[model samples]
Target chain A: MGAEFYHSVHLDVELCKGCINCIKRCPTQAIRVQHGKAKIIKEYCIDCGECIRICPHHAKSATYDSIDILKKYEYTVALPAPSLYAQFNNLDDIDIVLSALKSFGFDDTYEVSAAAEMVSEMSRNYIKKHREDAPFISTACPTVVRLIRVRFPNLLDHLLPFAAPVELAAQIAVKNAMEKSGLPREKIGIIFISPCPAKVTACKDPIGNTYSEVDGVIAIKDIYPLLLPHMKSVASDPEKCSVSGRIGVGWGNSGGESAGLLTDNYLAADGIENVIRVLEDLEDQKFGDLEFIELGACNGGCVGGVLCVENPYVAQSKLKKLCKYLPISRNHLGDEVPQGALFETEIEYEPVYKIGKNLAESLALMARIDELCKKFPGLDCGSCGAPTCRALAEDIARGFAREGDCIPLLKESILSLSETISPNQ
Target chain B: MEKNIKLSYIVSPNDFLSAGAVSEDVKAHLEEMEIDSEIIRKATLAIYESELNMIIHANGGIIDIEITPDSLNVEAADNGPGIPDIEQAMEPGFTTLKPNSDMKAKGIGKGRGLSNIRKCTDFFDIETELGCGTTIRFGIDLK
Candidate 1:
């Protein structure tokens, strides 16, 4: 739970009935059933929080920073993911949100989306360089990237190596504060107001060869109720605007990344399974002249994060209207801040993912998978306690769910348990 | 000694919805074994494509999968119209499926069923008569 790793998705012991719901739906086969409850396989888990988001029993939950951490920073910047703007209802202006943020002890609020604009432009340029492809694969969604690492190791080379827009935003915010105030880096802590658990996990365990640039991640859902009390309506006057309105916020929804980056021959893919399909096309070199590809592991992208506060569809609309009028984030924040600043420069790092030929290991895993397959009929009926057919397969592989975790087998076990009881007591 | 799970199901023709049922079950079994994704994908595609072909063209068939520790062996036999041209059908995109029928939910665009099954495994054998029937045997090395 410390800096070793940040896992936002967890099984709430009290709520979980030891069902395999999360186990079945995990895209990477990261979950397994143990003692009748679903558990996370840390090494395999990318922390996408699919279990947290899909659990109807509310057994799955995410971990984030404690509100106590706020006291550590002398000056705080509320760097909200663009998706945050999409959660509220009856919000007329940005000032209310800004003021509300101040009430929560933030000295100033910076838009993560502002840096996202530069990301948009950067992505466009990167895609232009690789336009002769089906999909270039969006680097913005960390969950989607992790999914690729586990499932499609062959396509790792196709991913853009740049840090995500949120990383860029955090880097810029920290550097700007460092240069402007000359404050010690420790005194000024940057807390990412994330809409998704994947971002939180990414901040904790970065991928593709670099230490994470983010200090801490706070899911927006945790702070929404606190901010709602101080919220007020802001006039639509452009003079009061401090950054790109929703340019960065637009990144919360599916297809929003592609929309944010104005480029031709671009394909936006949402949901882990769908992204896998598109990646296959990319592997085949079928989609030529493809300038860019945006992939989000969740159905509605960041808006659908397990830790987010509201309905994904509803949040998506809010983000759309919020950024509809604001200038792109690049022009807004980058222009306001002076050029030649340290924040504008990019930092280099090594990718965290490992690439090698482990045919022996893979074969062993496959053999185990075959053994697991022998247990269930692969109905994907959510009866064996796992959510999908593939997930049940993974559960067996991880030694979480037993081969006899199948429903009929479970029933037989229960009946046997009952039969073994003495009638006379 | 573990009892050999000898189970067989007839894959009737025109039953597209249920085409992958047995294969899906087999996949679940494989997953339970903690098999690697590559092996599972190979087994899945090979069985799934064969099942799809059985429903669309063969009118129906039977599949027998033998689960063993060393390896998994699959025998899928179809009774409808046999593949008249095995060599041509092995070519990618050689299916007799209607253009619209080619589309699947997963969006796989490969044209060669036999080729795909072959590519998905280390060994593949097909025996078919023009009017009698077709039987395919494939093995995935467990290592």
Candidate 2:
């Protein structure tokens, strides 16, 4: 909660027409309208890019490394997310995409799907071994992981304590670049062509892992325009591209990883709100039959990322079509997790609910808020600029707003006060 | 204590979608009051479990909550079919509903709710009457 690293989603203050749209849409309740502007509460923010998607004024934008940032390293390797393959039409061959990345100035392109395969294999083994009472949750989506830390802190132990596919991809890319180019580790950079902002935040300031091998993150949308013409041109020799099997590339959509796990009783939920409900059920121990749960913050999965150019459903169908072309006999990366690669770091819960400095004061404030809540209409109209009726109650209790601020309540009070002041008596 | 705060919620039966709404509201209230994190977690978990039980098993009842500087108390009263044996119901794996019963069909009854509620609260009690209803009263000391 201190001076942390950069968040993926930030407000373009100049363009912000603070309409309170993002505040209402935010699943984490991280956005607040203050002084006619929207501000993100960094402690509760998971960098899910929901604000970027919901912002009507185009005020919210995700930050990513430009192609210029990749120039600093002598050998820059681009790890294209599987979602990137689904971005183009009539491009069944993923090599064209890889080749397009190379033409876009990356020294080489590595398939992140391969790393995803490795991660999936390792996860299956882990799930089998760690057969505890609680179901194991996937860690591939950084936003979901952070959501657990923020909202569902009780279920933190259930999260699969593995490095994200992006991290694994970065590590492999860096290692491969160093081995092939004979460049020092510092001289080689691994840039992840991400479908979402969460990956960028993960690289900038890793949550679970102490250190990240990923040097930079570039959104797929940023690289898509440049790669379109290249993709249309001569396709790369399919032999040169490092391809992954159906299981790995299928991760762009929901239930893809669960299918790879080969588990009969696994639950998969996509989109931030849906994932939240699923996690609530998990918290209630409602999914007693399930052994694993896969949650993706985006609607369809990474393909539904705010930064993606393609429709999630279209991208999903394209990825599925490409999945059929994968050879029956495919290469699988060994689950050789680099030393110190696993996320052993303790992620503390966000303290958003803390009300008072001391127990006595907090109890008093809680009582006050409850009292205030009873007086206000429970309409949750959000007319008072608060997200909910309860929020307005807290605002009034905390002296940030007033009872008169509620338009309906103010009208009622005005009528009553006028009646009392009238000379009818 | 400046003023003892009280709240009442009428939880609807079979309303699975909004089963935990009351507990979430309580959590938000306690959070706004800045209660201790550990205490808040215990209270919210206990409240949520109790709320779920009322919705899934009972004929949807009312929950009354009273908060003081010293302790927080929640009394959930439901007019559904009462438990035949309170002791058995308190067990971790004991549930009145059959394995394929209505509640179990919806994945609601894991037989862990009552035990979890007991474990999370400092004080727990269940009062039930045959052919009548059940009332669960629990309290957690803020101190």
Candidate 3:
């Protein structure tokens, strides 16, 4: 809402090779490699950060709070993603990481998942109360939310209304800090130490919201070394840490939500493609009576996030070990939750790519889409941004795109030197 | 009243990879044809189950598809042991083929194949002879 154009993902012009790899990979067909570089259609991008992970050049990047920006506030609160433990190869004690975050210049460290416990309890009750007619989608992952916004708009009603662990943690921390010490909201900057760019974008333009509560984002990688020394200082004391129960902290991976809620009909799937397929099943009314579905953008879930230090393989074990016998989830009964704070209420949704202004116009647009497909055919090789050439034609038909949106044609035009060749000479 | 034009595909048996090919093709074509999303979804689901039937029990078959202004007709005919009892087959959990095509010694097994077809396509029809073959026809109206 800040700019109505705030982006968490961007293509670094210098790093991009104008390759259509991301164009092909984007499920929503939100990208178009027009001119020389790839451009993301702001309206179409759900900010899954699939490009950031897939790009070989490291060209696609998620924006994070600058190191210099830390100076703006009187104090910085570093709320590390639970995925951070997975980033380390042999890290055992959560305290070590907690101490290290202190070294990185933070007044205190908040385990974001601590608040997720409250969310877990609340979501469980919410699902139970609305069991019969609810198709509540998990709200833990921003990329998944974005995917719903751009691709599965029809199922938005199914998305459970809860602040993600990160948002919840931020709100709790802000509230606790204000109560404990009379600090102004502006004076305390709640910066999320994120494992993936999606979180950065989430904090920037949270889906289901007019504005994000997260003020800034810090990449775990940027602060990993800065906090390592503090881990040495606090090698013994476990009391100073925010060690959340395994069931709550276990929320990082696929199926974890169900594992926590303990619902028989729940489903959890990771990876953008897998999530989309599951969403399709949900849209088809497959899990009509199901209680919940957990979807993660990365393959093994957050452990698989691109920015983490450890491979998803190892994080799997670390997270498992950390949460082996998580305590019976504490009932935090809703804390008089503010009326306007929910992500579901904050974010607004309209169809991702409207076919037309009105029903008749939409019919006309469909006719146009048919014409375009007749011209382009349906091999969705992503040579065009619309997934299939057929989809591109439909966009053209709907007046959302044009023939010039195709990069191949532009490439051929340049090679043929159609504009520069001097026939008169 | 409906008028339709369709592109048919012949599915090959035991080709685990190409099991869902026909449905995939129909889905792509519907997009190209600019069919309504709801209509495309219903037709695709119906055709997918029909196509999978040819793969699972029919040892492969030809899917004759007809697309029209008002409806879509998909007829999957195969050269395999015809259904011994249409009533039992129609009932959910009565899979003549393996359970799910995936978990079976073959492919795609959740026993949801026929039930899925019933759940998807409207105007379902079936024709078969004991040792000869089977023919199934279904239509989806574009309302």
Specify the highest-DockQ model's number.
Answer: 2
Model 2 stretches astray by more than 4 angstroms:
A1-5, A236-239, A328-336, A396-405, A410-425, B1-3, B11-18, B27-60, B80-121, B126-134, B141-143
Question: Each model's interface RMSD (Å)?
Answer: 8.9, 2.9, 7.1
For model 2, the docking class works out as medium
Per-residue accuracy of model 3 over A67-136 as CA lDDT, tens digit each:
6677887876778787776666566667678777766677777887677777787777788888775768
Docking class of 1: incorrect
Q: Per-prediction DockQ, in order? A: 0.12, 0.50, 0.11
Q: Across residues A1-425, which tens digit of lDDT does each residue of candidate 2 receive?
A: 22373577889888887687888888876776766778887877888888898788999999888878787999999999999999888777887888777876789978888888878878877888878754888888989887787667668888888878878778778778988999899888888889999888888888887678888888899889989887766475533675688889988889988888987888889999899989876765555568889999998998999889999989999989988978622545455655444786776666555666776777677777767777889887666777776777776766777887776799898888888899484
Report the number of clashing residue pairs per model. Answer: 43, 2, 23
Cα lDDT, model 2, residue B140: 94
Docking class of 3: incorrect
- How close to the true structure is residue A340 of candidate 3, measured as C-alpha lDDT? 32
Q: In model 3, how large is the Cα lDDT of residue A140?
A: 83
Compared with the true structure, the alpha-carbon lDDT of candidate 2 equals: 0.81
Error (Å) of candidate 1 at residue B14 is: 3.0
- Candidate 1 per-residue lDDT over residues B1-143, each given as its tens digit: 23333447789887867866887777655543534556866787788888877877677989998766567788999996677888887887765755665555334445667788888887789898988889999988755
What's the lDDT for residue A283 in model 3?
63
